[model samples]
Target chain A: MENKILNKLKNSLDYLSGESISSDLNISRSAIWKHIKSLKNKGYIIEGKSNKGYKLISCPDILSAQELIPLLKTNNLIKDIKHFYELSSTNHSAKELARGEINNGTLIIAEKQLCGKGRFDREWISPSSGIWFSLILKPNLPPMEASKVTQIAAAAIYKSLLEFDIKVNIKWPNDIYLNGKKICGILTEMKCDMDRIHYLILGVGINVNLEIDDIPDEIKDIATSLKIELNKSFKRSDILVKFLNHFEILYNKFVLQKDISEVLSICRENSNIINKKAKLITYNKEEIVTCLSLTDTGELLVKDSDGKEKLITSGEISFRI
Target chain B: MENKILNKLKNSLDYLSGESISSDLNISRSAIWKHIKSLKNKGYIIEGKSNKGYKLISCPDILSAQELIPLLKTNNLIKDIKHFYELSSTNHSAKELARGEINNGTLIIAEKQLCGKGRFDREWISPSSGIWFSLILKPNLPPMEASKVTQIAAAAIYKSLLEFDIKVNIKWPNDIYLNGKKICGILTEMKCDMDRIHYLILGVGINVNLEIDDIPDEIKDIATSLKIELNKSFKRSDILVKFLNHFEILYNKFVLQKDISEVLSICRENSNIINKKAKLITYNKEEIVTCLSLTDTGELLVKDSDGKEKLITSGEISFRI
Candidate 1:
């Protein structure tokens, strides 16, 4: 009853007929006014007088299901949206949710994470100025192939940034660089059977409106935010909406096409390390190698001076300036 | 005080030296006799006499840290051995322990797991008749190179099983086959930064003494236990000890060798599908390809009839035969 009254009040802002809203929603005029006051306390603005009913003037820049749902454009890519004011980690919550038979594309977004986690159990500081979210995807691929999801996500973020005319480069494995500084990171977690992938969670963190002072000194030299790079403040909600839209398109292509070599080709073109001299490091040894190409399965092919080509499936390689 | 007394009793298991045992541990004679009775109930056979000391005749076939520690031959590979009678999952416990300041080569062994997990979040039924355990390794490799750890573990298990004159075949990814049926599975979970791996938990499950009826009906066609294959009972402790020794040796080789191609070569030689006709299935399409070889970094190379070689990093491939 409260939701209906609130919706009517919000709709009235768009010049919705008050009489129609009252009759259609079967709510009293006084009840609508009361709900409007409640919505105001929840960071929603109303315009006009009681006689004209109400109009939604603005919404707080918060990550709520109500706020994100209206902005998301994915068909079924985001079946459900869960919002956490604060959490230990969005990945931890999403992992537990995945265990409970949640549908693919379920998303868990948090405004702040008390114990945000980075790769290798490192601490991720997720304050309100960043986007901290995990999306559940059940791709019909083997467990090993699950790495492609991360690649696709990186491409999606790259494409989304291209919309804002922001120059971006994807670091191999999972980092987004802007002006030689990392602005985003992705962590892909997967559960699989021997031959098939059950589900995967793509945890993404983006520094949006974070100020330089908000970043730690150790990472300040290496990390930068969109606000810092662009020298202007942008809406976090708008960036998220753009990301979801771009992700939906890329993800659909990945699922439908199965082979992301074309996408990989695009990523390689925009990537800073392709066809460049790089230092490859594995568990056993490190060597100076030349980047050859990316295989269809996303393996990085590199050749040594002796012309010995190696297909690297997993490892960290850095481009040497 | 009680643990010290138990330790003393375990060390002096020759005769019922009640007065000597009590004096050595500063415990009462009645308390010593009570502990002996408890040990008997838990499957320890002790011979005792009024004047003679206690003698350990035999022990029950249960996996315990106390029993496995002496059996392990690795220098620091088995640095810490945690034994659980039953737990949710050995992998979960091992991962949690790895998050702490635990050393590499820590092993977590469980006789049973109520919610044993497999790749892709599938449930692995680990009864008392199976060897359910996880080993923590902090290999100094990049995250991408961690796949080699899986290959190394599979090779070690295959080689170890060959010692028993069992004709075992290496299954692609990580499974050991005995006479065309799966007897063991390995799941490798890793924590890593972009450049380096923090730790990895390699969970191994082996069907040792399970009867045919013990396996679920759905998996019965694909799974076989040692007892079912060999038509006899084998000692679980013996196999565990052998695996630890083999793992330590292989891990050392992996860390010390300049390149992992030597190990990959062994894995390829032992693989059942190499050079065989197989169907590779991905989300987008399926193709019949001939298994060419495994790349040094662990990608399976397959050649289509058109003579184009494709490196398969992730997806399901099955033998057509």
Candidate 2:
């Protein structure tokens, strides 16, 4: 009944009357008043005038399903959204969920992660103020093409930030940067056979509302959060909704029609490592190379110091920014 | 005590007195007699007399750890051997074990599989007469090099069968054929990230001692066993020991030395699809091609109908034979 009353307030442009809400939801006026009091205690700003029953001013800055589900515009890419107050890691939870009977686009979000992980099992500092979530994807693609999902995620983040008039560049594989500092990171993990991918977990962590002191001393010099960059705090749910909308469009193009032109265009325009001198490390060999461009299939094209041009699929490339 | 007595009986060349046996182990004569009686009840053939102590005539044809551990000749690859009376699938058990702190060469064997699986989750008929097992491998290699493990498994099985004076042809990827029938199948499953592999489960199922009537009616025409081919049952433990020995050598070379020359030579010499026209199927596309040879990294080099040479990895190639 509280959710119904909240939904009614969310859909209203003006103040809603108590009698109309009671009649619409088949509840008593006293029950509606009690639910409104509960919503206010839960961090929802509701104005209850004597005549104008209630008006929802704003939702909490939490990624709960109640706040995120009604805001998502996706059709199939996001079937369910689950939010936890705290977890070890969203990727760990998504992996546990993928082993069972699960639908594609099931989202797992956590307010804070105690043991967050990045690519190559690196430590990822996730606090309650940041946005950390994992999306389960079951794309009908082969395992060799699995890395493209990471590229799509980078492009989506770039596109979503562009909507806020905040320009960010995407690093080669799946890192987003603003003012030459790391702002977001994406880690793509998968379970696969020789030819087919069973499932993929796309973990995204964005430093949304973290202050300078929240970052550790070791990485503070290289990391910057959105609140630090923009000099103000922004709602994490707003960014999540826009990212999901942009991701669904890009993911559908890559999966359904087998096209990545839009994603390529966005990535190429906002790429930070393209045409830049970087260090390429693969297996046991390391060399300096000038990144030429991104291939049609999202591989990095580079020219080594010896003037030998080669395409790299999987590696770690660090730019001297 | 029972295993110690069995080991002593196996090492003896001729019958010994009961007094000597009891004195050597510092146990009473009645205790030694009780252990020998227990061994006999578990299907061991013991020759005993009132004066002469028991002698081991033959061991039961079971793939138990007690029988297989004593016969294996490996240093690191076969660290632990676990045999279950029955399981749903050896691969399933190995996967569960891989999620924990398991050693590299831990072996999981089942006397019978109630729901065995082959490549692509195809049903495999595994009875007590067959050799069904999964070996957990933790190779320090990239994800793209995973399919080579399957090829190594095929070469190992082929080499083991050749010791029995039965020449078998290795079908590309991972299958062993005898007399133009399917005698063995290998399935390789893995848990990996984009850049590294955490663990790999190599599941092998060989038709060792099954009779003609033991096979399912649907696949009886295509499957054969060693007993059916030779009209005599071979010991399952013997075949398993040979396979483990051969597998350890090949796996070590691939992981430690970063070499697969031996495996490639074995595969190329006994390849069933090389130089043969076969139907090549890959991700909804099928074509007729002539297989040329095996590459150094264990990929199939083939020429399609257009005379274009291509290296085939991770697909199904079926010959008309």
Candidate 3:
């Protein structure tokens, strides 16, 4: 009921009074006023006056998929957005959704994830203010090529941040760094056979408007949110819309055109670890090598200490500025 | 109730009368006699006389997970088994099981599948006599190295068939061919990120005792069964136990020892397409090439017509006798 009133208020942004809202939604004036008050408390700005009923001035910093779906401009992705107030993990939910005949670009977002996960099932600090979501992509590619989604994600997020006049560096495969600290992480999980991909759940968690107090004590030194870095809060929906748009553009280039040049170029242009020495860890073996460049297949081409060129396909690399 | 009677009968292989069984199990004598009659009609050999009740002779060709469980020797793979009389697909069930905190080596086997699935989501005709099962294995390896599981499965099935004195050729990746017809197929699906494997469900479908009338007309030309080739029915439980044992051994060596030597050797020795000319088909291209050898990384090394040596990672190859 509140959602219907909120949608009506958003639809009639010019001027909607409580009397008209009550008649339009078949409710009482007090009900309309109560929902409007609730929406305002939830971070929706409504200019309610004597004559002018409610005008939506601005949206709050909430990762609400209902609000974000209308703002997403990507085609064939996130057509059906499953929004949750809290979830165990978006990727886990996406995988269960993938088991069914779910379509590509179906986005699953949660305002807060109690057990958020990163790559290799690592714990991710996903606060309520952070943007946590998972997108199901059924690419017409083989399983071996599914690893390229992370690079595409980096390209999308890096380009989206650039539109906001905030430049961030991609830390190789999946993590984005801001001022030498982690700002965003991408965890791409796939359900696939040897030759064909069934579906891939790209779980992206971005620290958009989280404050320093929202972060945990363990990761406080390593994690930095956009609000803390800029000392100002930004709307999460705006970043998501920009991200899905950029992602759809680059993702088409990858799947349709079979071209990854634009994604690689963005990674190269915004890379801070390239040409610097970093520690690469695979399984249990660790080696320090000079970061060379991103390969055409999206692998990290580096020169090891033995002066031998190695292609790091799947591993963890820590970069130091 | 029926399974309990079967277990009691199996435990007491000696002659046991119906009156004694009824008193021991606290059931009516007529109930035990009816279940025994049903088991006999379903293919269990029991000796019944005037005074003596029933004596177990031999197990039949039914693919019963309950019957196969006691015969299995694997340690951690299948302690908890889900036996389905019929399922959509065992891999689908196994994948759902993998989504939870399902332990490693959890197995799901169905006596029949309503909608069995093969590689690339292809339809697999699963009749009642065929062995359709999926095993969930959580190996500590990267997702990039998951292609080796197919080779491990091929080796296990190949060695298991050899023990029964039935010679068959492995058709490249995961198909077992008997008398130039495909007798078995393997479909391996993984859930993972770029760097680590979460869990893999290895689906093995063997046409062990499928009759001629049971085979579909469209696939009759290219498919065969052990009973059709050998002129007799083989015990499905025997094959399942042998496969589980062989797979556990090879899988342990592959993951723990990091030794794929045995698997590679089996693949090479029994591969009929290793030195033959085959047609390779990729996403939108096809080329005829001479198969050279299996690389250490489990990729097929082939030489094209232009004297170019190319390593093929994921594609379909059709071989000619």
Candidate 4:
């Protein structure tokens, strides 16, 4: 019912009178007024006068489920969206939710994360204005091949950023860089038995419109935001919806069509480190290697210093950042 | 505190008088009587006569923490044991416990599992007579190398069962066969990031003294118990402690010593299916192959019918029972 009024206001260019809005929907004028007041409280700038009624000037950059669910393109994916004003970590919440009978593609979003997590249990500062969310995927595939989900998610994120003019680079495994600075990160966690992955929590943190002063000094140079690069703020809601759209396409392709060519191609476009020198660390051995190519299963193929080619899986590759 | 009274009764060969038991325990006669009654309720046949006081006539085939923790020789392992009368699955319980501040090496054992889980979420029938438990391991190592934990557990189980003089063969990946029938299976689940394993739940389920009538008709031919083979009941408490001791030793060797030789050796001792015809199914690709050898990471090496040797990782290899 609120969506009707919200959509009506969104579509209206001129002022919408209370009597017309109420008669068109057969709702009370007082209820329409109440809904308009609520929308205004949620940061929707509304211009109202006794003669002109109300007009929506703008909408805030809020990642509310009421805002995203109606705009998402995915059918079975992300229909049930959980939005939190503040949370410890979306990934933690996703794990707890995935343990039950929750459907796949259920996303957990937070405006601010007190204890956001990064790779290797590292801390991820997820302040307001950044996109902090974790998508629960029950892609019950072989455990060894679960790494492909990270690649798919990276591709989705990379494609989502293409609509904007910002140049993006997806670092191997799951970090995104914009203008040679880290702008986004993906941390994939899974609960699985020996044979198959039961579920995977893909926690994604995007520095969408964060202010420079809000970022910590330790990573001020290394971290960046879309607002800083574009010299303007972006609606996190738009980026999030775009990400879910691209993600739904890629995920369905991988699950239904059994094809990951787009993911690999997108990753290949950003993975310009081929023939570049890097340090590859696997197990307990560290060696200098030259990046060669990616395998069909998202593993990195690198040539060791001794000129021997090795397929590196589940390893850390460090290059000159 | 309960262990103190339990241990005193276990030390007493014939019968300890209530007066002596109370004096030795520094407790009142009523206190001693209460402890004895509790022990009796837990399937221990405590025969109480007028003068003989209390005698532990017999003990059921129960895997009690009171009996096992006292005998386990592993330091810092299995010291914190939770014994449950019935549960859905010990691995599920272990995962919930691991989310807390519980230390590694904590064990969760249940007398019966209502919904015992097998590899790939298959149903594992865990009746009352079976041994069902899961060990929590926080081995801070690369996530891909977590498969080695399954190998280590299989080796530990094999070594622990050597005293029983039963012919046991460890099928590749995680299955224990006795005289050409399935006797035990291991399901290793993990909570991990892309980099390292946070915690691993090593679930071990063994059909110890299950009767033929208790066995489901669907799996009667494929499943057998120790009682079916040896025609006698074995104490589950003894087997659990033995497995924990072996597990601790092998785990320390893998984590502290950075050595997996003992695990590989023990696995090879029971993995003698070389030159035998088997169907190897990996990633949905099935082929008729001959079992050749085991890899350092517990992957099976097999020779296809085309005389091509291939490494089989994360697959099910089925041979004649």
Candidate 5:
């Protein structure tokens, strides 16, 4: 009821009277006042006059469900969005929820993460200004095909950022790079049996609007945020909605039709490592290799110093740049 | 302390005097009596007299930690064994524990599973006569190599049963068959990232001493127990202990040495499907094929009707009797 009134007030240029809101929502006048009071306490600025009624001034920059749900263009892919003010890690919370028979495409977003993590349990500094979220996906795919999800996410992030006129390049496997600095990281983890996957948590951390001081000194040289590059702030919802839209389309194509041609094309278009010399870091050894192209299955095709071509499936690729 | 008294009483043929028992254990006479009384309540029959202390008459067939821990001969593979009379499912309990920073070899065993499950959420009717348990393993392997654990477990069961003079044959992909009837099933599930496995639960359900009446009517024709096959009741602890010992040895080889050659040998020795015509059951299609030898990596090598040899990684095999 509060969201309805807030929406009405937001859509209208003029004021919305209490009597009109009560009739529009089938609630009492006093109920409207009560809900308005609650919305005010939630950092929604509103102005009211005796005859002019109520006008929505502005909404706080928070990833609340009420604020994001109205902006999403997805259907069943994202049945609902859950936004938290703070969390230990979005992936941790999503994994706990994924244990239950939750719906697919359940989104878990947080304003800040106390102990955010990336691939291989690396520390991901999720400050208050960045976008930290995890999408719980239950794709009808086998365990071996799970790595394709990272490419889909990478393509989604690359295509979405293109709409903002920001040239972003995807570092092979699952990282987003802008001008040779890391901008986003996607960590895909799953619980699976021998043949089937139970559930997968697509944890994505993007450095959106972080200031220079917000980044730790140790990683400041390697990490770059959107605000640091563009000298302006972006609405996190706009970026998130765009990513979600692109993800839903690519995910449906891959899962339903078993087609990844579109996602692969986008990945090829924006990859920074392809046709370039990079260091392939594995557990036991590291070697210089020239990354070729992505295989049909999304593996990195690389040629070593000896000119032996190999398909790199699982490892880290450090760009020589 | 109670296990100490029970062990001493179990080893002794004659009744021990209370004064001598107190002196040996360094506990008060009343404390000894209290421990003995508690042991008796746990279904251990004791014969007591005026002068003689306590004589262990008989023990109930239960998989309690006190009973199974002393029977296992493992160093670090089985750090602890927690046995319950009943559980929803041992794998369910073990997965919960695996989420925490638990030990690698933590074992969860149950005499009865009220809601037992098999692969793909199939119902596994676990009566009190069965040995249902899950072993928590933290192998330093990738997600793709997880299916090898099932082969190791299958090899362990096959080798262990051979020691009992039982000619058991392994069906491909973790099922134990004796005389063309199913006797055991192993379900291995894991939580992992793209490159590393966090933990794995090796859930094993064996039809040990279940009578004909205990078998579900729907599966009675296909399922058989040790008692039904051999016409005698075998001790569950003896079978469980043997399995644990074999599993510990095989698991150590696979995890530490990255060698599954020994396990593959055992699997190839007892496989009933090899050199026989069986139906390869996949999700979309099923076809009759002659099962060939096991591959080095433990996958099934089968020849289809077209004489094309293919490597079968994940699917079910129904023997064409």
Candidate 6:
């Protein structure tokens, strides 16, 4: 009965008088009050008194099941939304969720992560001031090839920031930077046998509203946020929606087109290290080399002082200003 | 007092006669019995009875702080050993253990994994029949370059099996196959920043003593074990020791040599996919191609029927007869 009243209210534009809803739906006034409370708990903004009835104001913009469901306009890209108020890590949760029979495009979002993580077991501070989410993708590729997803995510985040007219550069591997400070990071976790990848979780964290003080002093020099760079506060909801839409496009191209050259080209165009003097540090040796270009297969091209060119797929990059 | 007694036992070449130990150790017979029982509980094998005192026969080949301390002889490698009776996953445990202050070569081993997993969230059956372990590596390289460690591990495993006269073939990207069936798999998980790798966990699983029936039918067609292939049960403890020792050598080379061309050369020599007619399957397309050779950087060289050669870093592979 309460659901019926809510349905009527959702379909109608007029003010839903509580007493009228109670009488029309054949429910008690207290019952109407209880339904309104439940809808409010689910992020519905219902206003007005018991006698004056309830008025639907506005909904919360958080990425909860309640909010995300109505906004899921794409076909099969986002099949489900699993929201957590707090978790150890969104990537860990998404990995667990993917282990079950969850469909592709499953989105796992957490408001806060107790043990949020970055690449190499670094602690990621996700204290409700940033966007912590993981998307489940079943890309048609082998496990070794899953790194392309990280490149696609880097491209997507770059494109999203471009929409806001923000100049964001991609740091090779998978990081979005503005003015040499990291604004976003992407980690792609995959499962595969010898031949094929079964599923992948693209874990992304964007520092949307984090203040400079919120980030630790040690990394404050290297990490910046949208609010810090823009000198204005923007809604994380809008940023997340923009990122998701942009990600869907690049991801669709990646899975459907099988050609990552275009995506790679875009990433190279926005890459901060391309054509720059840099230091390449590996396990045993550190070479002072100049960044030449990125290969079509996603490898970094570097030239030594002797002008010898080398293709590097993995190593640390240090820009030599 | 127990430490003193253990130390004495370590020095003693002969099992002390019961009366002699009772007098020399200044402990009663019953006390000696109790201490011997405790040592046994800690996986020390003791021989002889109360009247004969106790003789140390052989220690259990288990991964423990005490057991591994004597076995660990490498510098800056095998700094610590964490053994678990059961865990969610060794890779997960190692990643967590590596989060705080940890030295390179910290090893995490589990006898059983309740939620053991492989790449892409696939369930990795890690019963007592396999060696399930993860090694924490702090290579001074960029995170994207961590794939070289996988190549090192593949080379190590291949070399170790050759020591036993076991004919094993490598299936790209990182699997060991015997008789055209997989016997081992490697998963390399790295934490990284945009520029450098923070740390990495190289998880390795090898089926040692499992019989044919021990494997599920669906996977039985694609999986094999040492015992099944050798027609005899082998000691898991021996294989584990050999693997660790072999891995240390390759790992040292990986860190000290920086370039993995030496390791990759060995890997290519053992890989069965080279010079074979193959089918490359990506998400968007499948093509019949001939394996030409392997790049020094580990990319596969494939020549399509149209006589066009391409270097592929990621895709599924199937050998065409």
Q: What ranking emerges by TM-score with the best candidate at the front?
A: 5, 4, 2, 3, 1, 6
| lDDT of all predictions | 0.78, 0.88, 0.85, 0.84, 0.89, 0.77
Q: What lDDT score goes with residue B38 in model 3?
A: 89
Weakest 10 consecutive residues, lDDT, candidate 1 chain A? A9-18
Candidate 3 Cα deviation (angstroms), residue B244: 2.1
DockQ of each: 0.22, 0.62, 0.67, 0.70, 0.63, 0.15
**How far is B170's C-alpha from truth in model 1 (Å)?**
3.2
* Overall local distance difference test of candidate 5: 0.89
RMSD values for the candidates in order, in angstroms, are 4.5, 2.9, 3.6, 2.6, 2.6, 5.9
Label model 6 with its docking quality class: incorrect
TM-scores vs. true structure, each candidate? 0.81, 0.91, 0.88, 0.93, 0.93, 0.72
lDDT of 3 at A110: 92
lDDT, residue B285, model 3: 72
Q: lDDT tens digits, residues A27-127, model 2?
A: 99888889989888778999989966789999889898888888888888898888998999999999888888888889999999999998778899999
Residue-by-residue lDDT tens digits, candidate 2, B121-196: 8899999999999998888777778888998888889888889998998888888988888999998888777777
Runs of candidate 3 with Cα error greater than 4 angstroms are A1-14, A17-38, A50-52, A69-71, A287-290, A303-308, A319-321, B1-14, B17-42, B48-50, B304-307, B319-321
Please give, for residues B1-321, the per-residue lDDT of candidate 4 as tens digits.
456777777888988888887888789988887888888889888888888877877866677777776678988766478889999999989988888877787889999999998876789999999899998988878777788888888888898889777768888788898888889999999988788788898999999989998788988888898889889998888887788888889988898778999898778778757668987776546788899888776778888888998887788877752
Kindly report which residue stretches of model 4 are placed more than 4 angstroms away from their true locations once superposed: A279-290, A303-309, A319-321, B49-52, B272-274, B281-292, B302-310
Question: How many Å off is the CA of A155 in candidate 4?
Answer: 2.0
Q: Which lDDT tens digits does candidate 3 get at residues B1-321?
A: 777778877889588888888888889988988988988887789888768888888877666665877888987667677878799999989887887799887878898988898776778888878899998888888887887998899899998999899988887787899999989999988888888888888999999888888778988888899999999988788888899899889988889889999999888888888878999877657899999998887888999999899998877778642
Q: Which candidate, 1 or 4, would have the higher DockQ against the true structure?
A: 4
lDDT of 1 by residue, B1-321 (tens): 534544665676355477777777788888887888877776778787766767778877777776677577878787778888898999889866865688887889998889987765677878899899999888776655566777888888877777888768887778788888888988887754344666778899999999999888998877899999999988888888888888778778777674566567778888888888988775557889898888876889999989999887655566643
